[model samples]
Target: MELELRHLRTVRAIADTGSLTKAAAALGLAQPALSAQLRRIEKALGGSLFERDHTGARATPLGELVLERARVVLPAVSELQAEAVRFANATGALDRFRLGGTHGPLLGGLVDRIAAAHPVAPVSTYTAWSVDEIASMVIDGRLDFALIGACGESPPPLAERLTWEVVGVDPVFVMLPEGHELAGEGELELASLADESWANVPGDGCFEECFATACARAGFAPVSVFETDTASVVHLVQVGRAIGLCRATFPPTPGLVTRPLAGAPLSWRHLVGWHPRSPAASAAAVTVTGATRAAYAEAVSRSPSYARWLTSHPRFGTVA
Candidate 1:
């Protein structure tokens, strides 16, 4: 809750976008999550940062003061990171691996592969729900690479500045309690769960809107949709509080059953990216992207349901 660079970035984004919803979209955060974060920031700072109404958010006097400082600090920090990376590359000491990613198994799998490939490399990771946040780290030279996902054919963030390679594509799936009536079914029609509540981990892409549109196409709207963390989504599904949506490769969780939505109403694409101008691009861009694709293939091969589904679908799965 302490004042931090990220908080300043949040205030700046809100000020720039003039609306929490728009700022959240730009920052790759859910609107509710961003609002809650703003509330916490206001509490910690002992003042309201912005005047909020249906019209939009407008910065208060205090907000303007913070914005003034953030405008200076954020860019200065970016420059410092750029300089540090330049120094490292010049000295020929750019030997470490730094990665940023959203929540998923693929990041870990890729890390394992990288470690095996370069046993002496000091590898590190940063996790965020926001794809933009991860992408920005790479652009600012704070991280060497970014691993993230987009809904369907949606492109990864800041494509003009970074080189992105496809890892794999996965059909989105629903998680049901093991004893639920649908648990016995191999696949589900989207409309079949019209009355069910939905829960999913927050993501920065169009997946939220995509899900709603798919439900509309299926002829019904969800009764409720809960945007929460991964653990909460699983807990909600396990206790029958809600049905959870996840990547098709979601590992088996006891008391929960994962089933594909028939016709693949929704899908997710995995990608890895790095700033083309950064040392990582020349040093090990191939190594990192290769590890990611290999790791994804290994994951899919181990997922019986996904493997079988991929065989029949053909069009989905590994990008190559």
Candidate 2:
């Protein structure tokens, strides 16, 4: 009845697919075997992990708490296993690299570069919703590097222990309905948008903090509504229910347009950090920085509106 990595993974698979049958198929196990494992996990954890319906399973409140922690634990465990294999191979060289990233354009770009440079080395990625969580993994040696977005002159706390580099600065853009009165203009001042409701997820990089801080400076406190669903955020913006903060890296969406915030109150500095204990941490950081900039360049090409904004403002917005 003891919980192990396998049990945690079972929870993840079920939560992800939302069905016992699908989770079992994904893990190459019979449904009955997977069902039995769930029972054992529940016994060990002292509660049912999921509330099942005819359609599928969903985490209970207790299950939600465990699943959240399990996300972090699973990545670290996966990296640990990979490292053990490298040592077992006895070549004294890593067969692959591991990385974790908060939401941003740099991730896609960095992965592309790593595969090209280390064709033989396998690369694995894990997506985290917050920089703080990503920092934990970097400290644990689970990730060789982490890409974080910070505001103003602040560096994430882990910077002191790791080799950190500023890859580039991403200017925060305001996305709203295409037909909105303000969208007719090419740029906007944060103060003008103060009355608008904001869509934000707490702990999403600097999303909430930057938005609130900027609003305070604008002499108004924005009405913040928590929305974690991407589709909901899109709908709110399109219908003018709320406005959202985004970066140029996000592709153009129909019915929406992005404008630069004049006097940019919420710019985030792109940081790529690696601990010294990781092999070639400094060298890897350098390569990733270059890759990040390249990614932005490609993003501009794919998004004409963003490209125009970037061109009109060669320099990134300074934190207010």
- The digit string of per-residue lDDT tens for model 2 on 1-320 reads 56788888999999999999999999999999999989988988899889999988999998999999999999888768755653343323445767788766668877898899889888889877778778766666666678777765676756666777675666778788988889888779888987788774345445566667778888888766646655677788888889887775568889998888876667667777766655636465666666766765676677777666666676752211
State every prediction's TM-score relative to the real structure: 0.73, 0.65
lDDT of 2: 0.75
Cα miss at 146, model 1 (Å)? 0.3
Per-residue lDDT value at 292 in model 1: 94
**Tens-digit per-residue lDDT, 1-320, candidate 1:** 77899999999999999999999999999999999999999999899999999999999999998899999999899868776765554424448889899997699999999999999999999999999999877876778889999899887898877899988889999999998998999899999999999999898899999999999999988899999999999999999999999998888888899999899989999999987767787859988988999989888877798788888898788886
Candidate 1: worst-modelled 10 consecutive residues by lDDT: 85-94
**TM-score of model 2 (CA atoms):** 0.65
Pairing residues by index, what is the TM-score of model 1?
Answer: 0.73
